[model samples]
Target: MKLLLWLLLFVLCWPLALLALLLWPLLWLLSLPFRLIGISVEAVFALLRALLLLPARLLGHRGS
Candidate 1:
């Protein structure tokens, strides 16, 4: 789906499309740290949730 949109852009605006092609890797590199931070944040939230639920789990609470 994203490829189709990029192909359409390539047909309609070659220069912009070419620029996007060139910048793709740089954009991905720039985003890598943000992705890692997001993963860390998600893991922290999951740990908090598990810690919050631990007592209930130990008491044999069933999640449905």
Candidate 2:
């Protein structure tokens, strides 16, 4: 009885498992460029913010 139940579960899930396997690579390829662009934009914003703050920080310094 347990063996039969296991077989039924396996049969039901097999298609879903195969679908995920097939789609994994395609999804990864599609998202690759978007991920890289997001990272690049984040880096540029951080650099710009740092540059903008540098002058304020230097001007606020007291020459004691």
Report each candidate's C-alpha RMSD, comma-separated, in the order given: 6.8, 4.6
Estimate every model's Cα lDDT from 0 to 1.
Answer: 0.95, 0.93
lDDT of 1 by residue, 1-64 (tens): 9999998877989888789999999999999999999999999999999999999999999866
Q: Residue-wise lDDT of candidate 2 within 1-64, one digit each (tens)?
A: 9999999999999999999999999999999999999999999998998898888778895433
TM-score of each: 0.80, 0.69
Total backbone collisions for each predicted model: 0, 0
Question: Candidate 2 — what's its lDDT?
Answer: 0.93
- lDDT at 54 for candidate 1? 92
